[model samples]
Target chain A: MIEIKGLVVRYKTVEFKFDDYKFKKNMISIISGRNGTGKTTLLKSLSSLIEYEGNIKVNGEITYNSQEPILFNRSTYENIVYPLRIRNLDLNLYKEKIDKYTRVLSIDHLLNENALKLSSGEKMKVSIIRSIIFNPDIVLLDEPTTHLDLESIVELTTLIKELKNELTFIIVSHNSSFVEELKDEEYRLGGNHVYS
Target chain B: MIIESTMKAVELLFSFDSEIYTIIFLSLAISLLATATASFFGTILGILISISDFKLKRFTKKIVFTFMGIPPVVMGLVVLLLITGPFDGMNLLFTKSAMYIAQTLLVLPIIVGNIIISSEKTQKKILETATTLGANKYHKITLLIKEIKPFILMSVILGFSRALSEVGAVMLVGGNIKNDTRVMTTYIALNNSMGEYSMSIAMGIILLLIAFVLHTLLARFRGDFYD
Candidate 1:
């Protein structure tokens, strides 16, 4: 569960004030707004990536996947396993679990390929998988489906739905159909106000 | 006289003249060692300044950037006073050690300035991503170092060139002692003053070659950065 109160984020001369709300645990919440609506800024503030005037109470560890997924100049496998390595988790023990995810996502064939050379959609898939592999308590996805193909989008939402029973997902997307299929709650932002 | 000196310089270079080689060896050895020492500490200083946010952050950066343009002669005079007055019993005055210290001072700012710029450009992006992935401060620093390594290498080459071509500071403390603290630059100065045009011109060629190699290495590192 995550709770926010009196949240104000400012960039240069513009400021955004977010509604005070509590996000339920183990649910997918969609945050939808038109272009240039500070959707990404809100997500980043939640992740503690930017400065904000607010109080946030989070249940557990948080992970943020940016709109454009970042891939290193290494193999796809390494990119997926980076978070685990950072946490000093044993790779061999989790090999089977990682393999299962890769197989399900149809990324097993790309395991040894250079992640930096992969197409945008492929890189986004790898990035999304990497973000959740370590089981963050709250996962923030900003425009996640922007570069993903239809099939990859389906797989992503399916994976999120299956995992939502144990994880809290805060997603920002312009894809209405995808949101309609997966969102448990809608948080709409526009005209300097938040509508829940 | 210029054509005669050129012929003599070519002949001396091919024959590996002992006096010239000794001077060359000392100059290269001192400059390389000084650059290495400066690089070690300067890298830490630069990274700290880049990643940290403090009240004096802007002022500290300003100081470092200003130091990058410090006159070598000014540095030499300060060091000379320190060695002869405060460090009297150390007997460091008029020695290669003094020359090394002076050169290190000259190059440290170059390394630090370059690193600060490189770190500022790269640290934010890498830190944002690393922190989201649960990386600690040490891990983020390592990542920062890896991404800015090409810039560091370029700074080192730049420092080396500056140290190699340095004459004022080394001359002040080294005293240009023959076959002892004498380096290529001081030696060139000495021969030129004594009308030993051939020897001075030969040393000039060696200095130019050193500069050329440093520039080439810098270009190569720049290419690596872009790639």
Candidate 2:
């Protein structure tokens, strides 16, 4: 479970004060706003990548996947297994999961290719797989669908929906269809969140 | 006259002369050693400078970047003073060790400066990514180094290039002693001064070839990684 109280992010002179929100575990929530509204800033703040004034109560470890993910100068396999490798986790434990997810995302062929050469959409897919493979507690994805095509986006939406039972997600995206399809709740940065 | 000398230079290149080969081999060994040593320390220092936040950061960077342009003669003088002064009884002047010391100093700044600049550009993003992925301090540093290895290799190559062309420092500290400390650059200078144009040209050609081969190797390394 993750709860935010009086979350405020200030960059230079512009300030963003997000409404208080409580996001439950084993669910997908969406944070949406227009440009300059600090949507990504909120995600970064949650990840502790930037400084902010707020209380973010999270139950477990977290992973933040950037909108434009940084792929190392290595193969996609290396990039995908990075989060696990760094945690000193047994990569063999996740081999089956990696294969399953790569097939779902249709990036199985790209696993051995140089990651830097992948198309933008392919890179985003790689980033998504890398992020979720380690099965962190809270995953914050900032505009992850920006480079993804419609079919890829649908595939991702399904993947997130399927994984939401095990991993909590706070996604910042403007893809209305994706948000409508995957979100169990929605939080507007400058406004309030609606929980059905 | 120039063409005649070039012809003679070509002839001498394949002559299998022991002296020429000896000087070539000595230069390659010493420069490789100096570059390797400088790279090891320079890259560590560079990574430290990039990751550390201190009050004197700006000032320290200014000084280091300034040293990147330090003249070989100036470095030679500094090493000369160090050896001839406080360590007078060391009898270190005009030896291969002195030349090695001088060349290391000459190449250190180049390696450090290049690494510092490249690391500064990539460290923040790489570290941020690693942190988000739950890496500890040791893991973050290791990942950063692994990711920026190409840039580190480039710094090493730059250091080697600087060491390969070095003449002033080696000439001063090495005394260009034949069969002892004579290297390609110093050997060329010595031969050129003695009207041995063919020998100088032969060394020059070999020097250029080494540079080309190293650059091609770097290109291949970078290409393999960058798609």
Evaluated with DockQ, which candidate comes out highest? 2
Interface RMSD of each: 1.3, 0.9
**TM-score of candidate 1 versus the correct structure, residues matched by position:** 0.91
DockQ of each: 0.61, 0.76
Q: Where does model 1 exceed 4 Å of error?
A: A71-75, A100-122, A149-152, A193-196, B1-3
Listed per model, the TM-scores of chain A against the true chain A are 0.95, 0.93
Query: Could you tell me every candidate's TM-score relative to the true structure?
Result: 0.91, 0.95
**Consecutive 10-residue window with the lowest summed lDDT within model 2 chain B:** B218-227
Worst 10 residues of 2 chain A by lDDT: A187-196
Error of model 1, residue B145, in angstroms: 1.3
Model 2, residue pairs in steric clash: none
Give the per-residue lDDT digits (tens) of candidate 2, residues B1-227.
77888899999989889999999999989899999999999988988888899999889888889999998988999999999999779999999899889999999888888888989998998889888888888887788788889888988987898898978889888898889989999888988999989889889999999999989978976775565
For candidate 2, the docking band is: medium
